[model samples]
Target: MFKALVVEKNEADGKTSAAVQELSEDQLPEAEVTVAVEYSTVNYKDGLCIGPGGGLVRKYPHVPGIDFAGTVETSADDRYKPGDKVVLTGWRVGEAHWGGYAQKARVKADWLVPLPDGLDTRQAMAVGTAGFTAMLAVMALEDHGLTTGHGPVLVTGAAGGVGSVAVAILAALGHEVAGVTGRPETEDYLKGLGASRIVPREEIAETVKRPLESETWAGCVDAVGGPMLARVLGQMKYGSSVAAVGLAGGADLPATVIPFLLRGVNLLGIDSVMQPYDNRVRAWKRIAEVLPMDKLDSMVHPATLEDLPQLGRDILKGQVKGRVVVDLNG
Candidate 1:
């Protein structure tokens, strides 16, 4: 038996209470591999799965963590074996099947990736979905040929998980990072993550009267997708691309097509979940090599499984500071 944060719905009322409950090995879903899950972290998806806002959970007694790292304990497939370290993310495993919130997780072999060098299980959870999404955005921009001389790179939601790592990676790769956040208090914090300057969320939130404004960003890793994303589109440089990762502000994108037709701006959508295995492997490997650990450390804090309830509430209220690493055995 092992302990896991189990969310059961009040069938009569549709509310959820995520309580730590003891579970047997058979309780886990059927898959080709059984993992001794070491660490899992809360992402925005996890917050929703734990609470009501996200509309992701379709059943009661669900496990909500979307990302985890662990060691293989048993495998029916030849691709992996016992004692091998592995990482699991995306794949709708948390939403459609059992996920990584417990001491054990059985996942499809196709959903697993060999943990890249330089990142242990705990550190992999430190990177989690947030940092991995950040890496995908960075790769999308770099693949679009964005360079240091292309001008200042803008990162929205700069103080959050994805923003923090995106800033660090872009800066580490030689581009000047302009971080956007509503929290003025995190200015020094953002700079310490290699952001060269801070742009108030208001500065980016303000809408442009004209369809196309003076080109400001060479490329952008935009995490907030509302009017903020809509506004940023008008200010993008010619032929520049924006990797849209999250919709923290809202999902409704009120944008004009002028930026695309006139400036040749590209709106590239990035989805970490349901990502192909090869892409997932490449992104993780890139994250291991390019993400500045010291900078990433500055963007992280330690949490425990017991703390998930309150932490879930905090993230929904926009009070979370950075990546939260959950030490399961602690």
Candidate 2:
């Protein structure tokens, strides 16, 4: 038996509550590999999964953790063996299937990536799905002619996990990074992670009156969607691109096509989920090579499985900063 954070629904009241419970191995979903989950991270999705169903959790008594890093304890798949380090993300494990809120997890080998060299299980979870998505956004921008010398790159929702990692990676790659955050207190924290400037959330939170503004950012990794994204669209430099990563602000895109047609600006959609294996490997390898350990360390807020309930609620309220790495063994 293993300890897992289980979200059980009270069918009578149609409400959900989460708690740590002892679960048997037979309770694990059918899969090719069983992992000794060492670390997981709290994400915005996790908050919803841990609280109300959010339509993501299809059943009662769910385990909610979108990403985890661990070691293989048993494997029927030849691709991985016992003691092999692995990372899991973006296969809808937390939402649609059993996830890594437990000390043990059974998952398909295809959903797992061999933990990249130069990173341990804990550090891998530190990056989690958020940082991996950030890397994907950065790579997408780079593919579309984004270079360090082009101009300052903007990272929206900058104090959040995705924005924080994006800022660090862009800064490390020699790009001038402007981090956008509503929280004034995080200015120093964001700067510590290599953000050259802090762009206030109010400055770009609302929709702009003009469809096209002065070309400011050469590239952007936007985590806050809604009007902020709409505003950023009009401000992109000519022929530049913005990688849309999240919709923390809202899903509505209330903007004109003038930026695309007139300024030749491109808006690239970044989806870390269902990314091809080769690209996933490439991204993980790049993360291992480029993301500075010290900078990543500065962004970490550690927690344990027992702290997840409150942490989940905190994340939903945007009260959590950087990444919340949950050490299962701790």
Candidate 3:
């Protein structure tokens, strides 16, 4: 038997509770690949899955971990075999299906990617789904004609997982990175991650009034998609792009199309889940080559299976910082 964090619902009260339980391999859902999960990570979606359904969880008695890295223990597919290391991020594993909050996980082979060279299972989990999405955002921005020396590339929700990695990667690529964060205490943290300037959240959190602020940011990787995103849309430089990754603030977009019509601003929607396999491979390989390992190390905070419950609660409250790497064997 192996250990897994299981969430069960109290049907009468319509409430949920999570606990670590010993489970057998037979309990796992049928899939082509069975991974000996070494490490996983906490994400915002995980917070919802660990507590309430958030419309993401399809059923009860579920496991909640959006991403993990490990060695393949068994595989029915020709593409993967025993002893090969792999990584998984999207495809709703922790929601509609069994996930990586356990010592082992069985998943569709198509959802797995070979772990990039120079990254161990633990290091891969350190980069998790959040970091992977951050890389996607960066790639989207660059594909739309963003380059260094144009101006600062703003990263909204800068202290969070995606923002942190985006700031580091953009800075590493010789771009001036500005991070927007509400917490003043994280200014130093953001700067340490290669951010050159720190923009207070309040500076851009308000709804757009002018609909065309002086084209300030050369580009943006936005994880906050409410009014903050609306405001940033007006601030983007002419013909530049803003990659919308997450909706931490809110889902509503309150703004005008003047930025698009007048300044030629491009809003790129970045979807990590359901991404084509070829693009996923390209992003992972780029992450391995571009992201500095030391910066990635600084973003990591270790946790065990037991710690996930509280971590989930903390993440929902927007109190968690950086990345929380969960070691299955810890």
lDDT of 3 at 232: 95
- Candidate 3 residue-wise lDDT, 1-330, digit = tens: 999999999999989999999999999999899999999999999999999979999988999898999999999999999999999999999999989999999999999999989888988988999999999999998899988999999999999999989999999999999999999999999999999999999999998569898889999999999999999999988999999999999999998999999999999999998999999999999999999999999999999999999999999999999999999999
Residue-wise lDDT of candidate 1 within 152-196, one digit each (tens)? Answer: 999999888888889888998889999999999999998998898
Candidate 2: what lDDT? 0.94
lDDT agreement of model 3 with the native: 0.94
TM-score: which is higher, 1 or 3? Answer: 3
Clashes of 3: 0
Q: Which scores better on lDDT, 1 or 3?
A: 3
Model 2: residues with Cα > 4 Å off, grouped in runs: none
Spell out the clash pairs found in candidate 3: none
The model with the greater TM-score, 1 or 2, is 2
Which residue pairs show collisions in model 1?
Answer: none
- Residue 96, candidate 1: how far off, in angstroms? 1.7
lDDT-wise, the better of 1 and 2 is: 2
Q: How does each model score on TM-score?
A: 0.98, 0.99, 0.99
